[model samples]
Target: MISKSTIDTVFETARVEEVIGDFVQLKRSGSNLKGLSPFTDERTPSFMVSPVKQIWKDFSSGKGGNVVAFLMEHEHFTYPEAIRYLAKKYGIEIEETQQSDEQKEQANERESMYLVSEYASKFFQHSLLETDEGKAIGLSYFKERGFTSETIKKFDLGYSPDKWDAFTNKARDDGYKLEYLEKTGLTIVKEDKKFDRFKGRVMFPIHSMSGRVLGFGGRILNNTKKAAKYLNSPESDIYHKSKVLYGIYHAKQAISKEDNCYLVEGYTDVIQFFQSGIENTVSSSGTALTPEQIRLINRLTKNITVLFDGDAAGTRASLRGIDLILEQGMNVKVCPFPEGEDPDSFARANSEEEIREFLEENSQDFIKYKASLLMDEAKNDPVKKAGLIRDMVNSIAKIPDNIQQEVYLQECSRIMDISDEVLYATLAQIQNKEVPSSSRQGKQKMEVVREKPVTTPKVDQLYILERNIIKILMLYGNEVEDFEDLLLKQNDDTGELILEPDVQQSKVFEKVFLDLQEDEIAFSNEDFRELYQVLINRLNTGEEFEIGNVVNELEPSQSKEITDILMQEEQYELHSWDRHDIPVKKKEQAVNQYVTQTILNLRRHLIDRKLQELLEGIRTAETEDERTDIKNEVVGFNKLRTLLSERLGRVM
Candidate 1:
């Protein structure tokens, strides 16, 4: 319901790089920026952003769009919600348009759940800051943890009263359906009875990376043996534990800026680290690591340091996650707290410098951590020792980079006192082997399948000539000058050489390229065709074409092509470093260079064949006049060839 003007203001004010950089750690790639794919787990950067285009594209996911689309895709926000988010971020005043009650009633269940969750977050925050019990318990708990009032407001910390049906009755009175309340896990309903889900607990709302409240994690204040220490919102439509990382919304910028992520296991662990001046930290929330979670971190950093609880079981359980990180091409290091300590306790005990120093000194490669922990169990037992070596080799094989994998293998060999060759051989075998016999058979069949051949129509010479014209248009479509050319015409009464004034063209590219533009000029791939059309549209609109915008619009495969085209090479050198430092040719000079060369090359090939025909006719001449004419034509053709070759810079 936000006004269009407000939306435009937000879009214009919000810098694409700045907004995306909150989640993506971007590095300069020529005129654009590149980063690891956020939509997929990747070690290498395949996601691109163009400040000029104000858009982004993930080459691995084949999803490209403007800032709004990224928010929608990454956070699963409805269009309205995304606009509202931008408006809030940019401090724009949102003026809602009138909507019919009937139209408003048509909102879907998922959207209703989002609405309910948002309302619940606000209600809890209000309760915490505005009520006595909440102030004494929830506010005090946060203040005791060193969270300032601004930080508390920033995170929207909240409290739910001991009254069970307080939230439920309030929501019902507000016209939010009970179904949505249950769907968002904010209210529990049983056999004609409804009550709040987190009553009597201090609230910590978990947010998606886009800052939408997905769920909540609540802590019980009163010590009671009958009550659980902590409770979380059950899996709902918007919150998937395996895919969501707590504190990511707040910590993403710090994580990306540092180029490293600190992975912890609990909500408090993340908050404490941030409070202690370590802001690049997120929690898995005690869940086993998932690929989706790994990709989320991968988008911001290629390096991750896991802080494990000092307990032996906690360390062993977290060791498996290292392989997942390795598979995604991330550099992982492990830091184990002292016995019986977690990140929360450890941070509370030391100063920021002390905590940092401890991490720096103790963080070791995952392979080394695994070997160090497991080697003792296998000591003096040959079978167990061999088994441990194989386990390390398997973990090494999961690494995508050859150099990194080899390095890990060498380290493993040294640590286990095994031969390096043996470890290498084992890793190679593990990598080459298929997942299973059935899967291998299916893959082999796919590899053996051959494509059928098809004939294609030959392009007319004019078509090739036109293609050259299109290429020129794509390269230099914004020229502000005109080009002049000679034109020949025949008078009505007599055929003769005539000179006429030819109006200078604004841009030869726009005139010629658009003249030949057709909706039917299809590409083999739809995405390529889509990208080509977008490029043409941008050129026709007299706007500066952005290769990143096209990349964002195209499929992932086609996006790679667009990115490669824009970033492949400089394509033209401005000036060479030499004595006197002469400047490169001006725009007009560059255009003329391209145009004159192409025209002359085409003319040379055409005339060279014609000259051969003229010489052949000299041998077949039946009359002296014909022979003389043929000789004259041959001389003229040779002269034309010489002129063209010179213009084209070719020795003929």
Candidate 2:
């Protein structure tokens, strides 16, 4: 377990901008930075980062958080994993408490798989870099392909020895279970015979966008007729090939910075392009591009440039990914390498500048690319041309953005020599036709209106206080106020006034915070609980209570709650106007002040109600001591009510 001191060190050391900037291309927007949402595909910037507050919020998908929380959400890292990640990034040494066997067993299956995969990756890398046969075969193959030593190391390229049981034996001997090795497809076990699955092949360690190695791709160096050209790790708990994109871990930063992703095929293509200084490139790793993989890239960049080889199969396959990209609300451009050449060969043949220039000049939008590619086949056949036009419209219909769809329709109309109206109509028809058959069949409609929970005067009063507490949390959670003294009478025989100083030394937020702390009030929602806990801790540590940071720490639901309060229609301008030059009535300037006071009044009322409830509960106890406590609390609640009325300029 990570100690409290370790967590504090991570928070103090992990700069919000540095951690978020690794995944987002944050351009300065005043005191904050803005970028396209990493949680959703969008062109205009909605993901905001405030360096002052040390938090981020993505308005599109509604996910917001500090550095650790962001990593937890975006990379699927556990709390400890996120802390460890930041620790490693900032070079902080972590000292953890000892774990028992039960604690080890508590690691989730997915996490366990990830740990096993990481272990296997290190083992493979060691075999390649630390052994003679590995350097001689695997390293030599990569070096011969124009991959630098640095590039090989950066990608964690490795090789499995040709001998059977070499990797499996080593893994088993190192205390790794054979079941995990087989599950990750690192070893092939048949009839009590276990052998290395990727024997004699150079390894391409495939990683998640967060840089955790999920699985591997291996290319055969041998030309034997029996051996396949390439092999990849089988689908496992942590690795789903269809959903994984090669080089995303390395390319995410560049992709976001450029707002573009260059898609390629094969492991060599990814390595060659990245080594050539084009860092925003990823590969499907020779698999047919899946919607899931495209969506993953779309999260980082809205613009995708798919590089296709010259072959017919490549062109045909490129067509398959276009509709998927359009369905995901991304702008896709196709860049086909010269006939008989792939990205690897082309990048290797030409200079970086030349290759870059070629890509810039040749990259065409999907509408144009599809039309042009299919135009030859359609030739002068009216039937084929009609089919092609309909196909283009169908692809256009897949786009989610109305404006983008309209623009594409215009472009398609121009390219296909059809009318814009005709294309739009065709798109609508296709979209309507594509609706699910299940949705059209047997629909049972139940009109039910749930009754709103009855709100009593007590509840309303509590609601107001809750608002004030939230406001204080959002605005002045870190402020410390001097304790105020109040006089209270607590005797029957003598009219004696007891002087009680509010030794709390806390702001309004801190008062509510301390109350919750004492009661152990916990949020039921996971993300909300995390945000609430972190904010309280920050406030306690004398760290500035940044609204942005608190908002960012919240998960989507908590973000919505914050947004509803901060951005709602509670305040409006009071204006007077006339048709002529003269105004009918004077404009009011106290609108905002009134709103603020009303909110504060409501908040105070809520707190008073809660205090009253607590007092009443204490009174019901049969003990004299509890009764005495209730009497004291009653005084406090009365004083709170008096202060609340004073704040609103009302006489009690």
Candidate 3:
């Protein structure tokens, strides 16, 4: 049997156009090459080959396939013969029969490239530690950056010697295929020439969450305007810069343990924080923060604290990334270093404890951080300040959680000392613009709706809230925990508003039942309404609620509804990542956040509907007293909505 690695190498090196060009006189036809059908007597060009897709089609003969398939069809060769032909033509080493276990492990092209990357990681580390040029340039740079020897080895820090073919020639000599080296972006191959992509650069191996090296981020140590300061592996089969996080392999456990992850901009920031004993840190590798990357962190923790450089201009430029975090349902905080300092510089100056303390004390939620940053510059100019306020409103509109959006708007109002009406009006305008919500980089849910000729999804907000309430009751109905309750009270002394956040321990069902009861609300969906009562009755018995027992008594449709409600969160979890892809330790499900948010969302949904009804009544009322009564009820509902908004943030 031909080894899978050999097959993969052959495929990688054998270009479809080049291989077919040997037999067919192909000519450029737009993006593809077109020639007369070789298998049939056709005067017009009917054989078309695409270099980009690496496949060919003979329209006249009705034959189509890859390079190897083409060889098998045209040259009357067997599968093995075609493989051998390409292997010999491309100079790829071919292995056949009696394959070793390691050779058997290479299943596909992507897997083979991964092995090449792993070897390259080791090669670079060896160069850093053993080579004279590597030690002089790379080792000296790290020492100058204050990276301890232990930290250096821990991160597998490495150096690529300053020569075009230093690493490339070595990789080839050691039986690592040039085809894979090129695919992994470690070597730039042109015609018959190839050279190391990161020559003369310090290599930081970017690892998958399972600790397998995916690619490299190479840093140029010298002051050279000719090259990028940092060069990343080009997007490949195994590596997507937007989807991977630097230091995530080392920081996953720490992030779940600490219940937070510190996000920075560069590789050294993560390395410095890790060395400073703050291992719960990661970087986007100098790229813009991405939702995929945020989602990668989301599996470990909901909280992300982004460490910003002291330069306010840079902060303002990337502050737009904060919206990505917000849209993905992640809580973001920002901590800016003192003027002219960054994570690397500050960590060098401060002790481990001071570094940790500084992060703790200085970190502010994104709302406060963004408002303060914009308010500073815009404060000096009235027109710019108006633009700043609108920009802030744009961010506030991106938040998916209604309660979170309301809370953020209130925060914005407090910071600008502007009335809540203005911000809320701007938010309403933005939300009602009829523009489809979408992201350019992501497989957007909106794009899916727009592109497919499917009926628009009818989202029932109230029904979703009801389903969520049932889900919460099903999971934590009998469990007791401290839940923060917001109570709006009038201060007797000064008649000022005082919101007291009372932490009360109660079973989850009790909290859900009482809140709905207090609001005089019932599930608008009959199924959820009926199921809610049944679950509450079971929970009220003071015995642990067994879903099995309750589900057994229900009708088939009701039972399925109940079952779906219980399993819904798992079924639609944002990050249902494969264990083989990245074995991230699972964080405990956030029972409290889910429970409280569901209840608040239910309240807001019901109240907003009620407010609309009251407004309608006020318009249609036949008498003065009737209109006055409706107006008073509207005031009461508005006040209640305000309290719910305050409780969303656990503050006024």
Candidate 4:
């Protein structure tokens, strides 16, 4: 387990802008840095990083958090993984507490698989550079393919010995259990014997977006007609090929910077393009493109230009992938190399400038490309032409944005010599058929109004007041304030009760805690109640208030809620009343008044709820005497509500 002090050190040392800026291109926007959201497809910037607050907020996706939270969300990392990542980034030496055997036994299975895969990657790389056989075969092959030593090292290219149990034996010698080796697909065990899975193949390590080795793709060097040329690791706990794209770790920054991604087909294609200066590229790793793969690219950029070889199979793959990209609401383009040249060969033959120029000149919009490719086959046959038109319309309907769909429909109309009206009608018909019966029923239900059941307004009001109080406590709980307390005392001469007000200085948290305790009030919401107790405990123990400290102690969902509260200021800051020349009261200036009103409102809400219960009891009373007693109780509660209302300056 990571020590609390180490987590705190990591959080303090890691700067929000510096961390996120490694993956995102952030331009200065006033006091914050703004960029397009890495989580969504958008041209305009809605993601803001505040260095002063050490937090970030993506307006497009409504995800906002501190540096560690960002890593957890973006990389799908566990809490420990995020902490370790930040610790490494900020050069903080982590101090961990020793765990018992039982605790160590409880280590996550996925993390274990990650460890084994990382070890295997290292083992393969070492073999490639250190072993004579590896150097003679794998190193020679990579060098012949025009891969530089630097490129090979950057991509973590490696080799496995041709022996059956070379890697398996080495891993066992290193004290790595054969169980995990088999789990990561590094070793294939069959009937009392184990062997390396990628024997004699040059290895391409596949990495997660955070650069952890998830799996490997190995290319066989020896010409064997019975064996496949390229082999990938089987699906494991840590690696799902459908959910991963090769070279995404290396290409993500470039993709976000260029606001476009170049999709290729193989590991060599990605490496060659990256080495040739087009770094914003990824491959499906030879698998047929899936929606999951397209969505992965969609997260970084809305535009995808698929680079295909001149072969007929490559063209067919591009056709299949284009519709999937459009389905995800991303713009798809096709860039085909000259006949007999793939991304690998083309990149190796051309200089960076020539490659860039050829890509620019050959790239065409997918809609246009599709139209051109299918038009020839449909010539002079009205039925075939009609089928082609329907195919185009189906692809058009996959687009979520109506404006983009309309533009494409018009383009299709101009090319196919059909009217836009016909295309619109066909799209409507297609969309209508796609709507499910349950969804239509839901729409109908929304259109019809139903009588609302009786609800406790006081309870709802109290919840809001409780949330506001907690928000204030989190923001300004440690500040000292002069708090007014109302006291009841006996008059000296008349011997009658009189209300006296006393002002006392105390921390805001202390004042709020005392006020709520005096009224015996507790938060109605369970989360708020729990947080309130934690804050009170911290205050009582003289712990200083820090948002990051509180967030670290919270569960992820609660942390997100706290982040939402903290980031509300940034969201509101974007809409400055000063820009409109309107007088707006600052929150700090009215802190005392706001706190007092929030407490009074909560008290008044509780009183109203008690009065309502008394009224209900009165209606259900079996005798007149019982009803009278309930009415008397209601009268006292009403008087308390009136007093609270008076304090809040409300006529009730």
Residue-wise lDDT of candidate 3 within 1-652, one digit each (tens)?
7887888778767788887765555778777778766676444666777675566777676676677667767655556667887888778888877867785655467667877998999999999999888889999999999999999888899999889999899989988788889999999999988988998999999987656688999999888899998899999988999988999888977886787989888999999989989999999998888877887776556788988899976686568788998887778899989999999899989999999889889999999988887889887798999999998999988878899999999999999989999999999988877364444334466667778777855556667667777877776788887888877789999986668878898878888888888878877788888888888888898875655445545654566576455433333445432211111112463666667766776677778888999999999999999999999999988988887767765521
**Highest-scoring model, lDDT:** 4
Tell me the deviation in Å of residue 540 in model 2.
8.5
In candidate 4 the C-alpha lDDT for residue 522 amounts to: 73
Clashing pairs in 3: none
lDDT against true structure, model 3: 0.79
lDDT of 2 by residue, 563-652 (tens): 543422122112221111111112452322333343445445456657868877885879988888877877877776666555445311
Per-candidate TM vs. native? Answer: 0.77, 0.75, 0.54, 0.87
lDDT of 4: 0.83
* lDDT score of residue 391 within candidate 4: 91
Per-candidate clash tally? 2, 8, 0, 0
Residue ranges of candidate 2 with Cα displaced over 4 Å: 1-5, 25-30, 34-48, 57-65, 96-102, 436-467, 477-600, 603-652
Q: Backbone clash tally for model 1?
A: 2
Off by over 4 Å in 1: 144-146, 223-226, 432-434, 438-478, 485-503, 507-510, 513-652
Error of 3 at 584 (Å): 34
Rate residue 531 of model 2 by lDDT.
50
- lDDT tens readout by residue for model 1, 154-191: 77889998898999999899998888898888888899
Q: How close is candidate 1 to the true structure, as a TM-score?
A: 0.77
Q: For residue 480, what is the lDDT in candidate 4?
A: 82
What lDDT score belongs to each candidate, Candidate 1 first? 0.76, 0.74, 0.79, 0.83
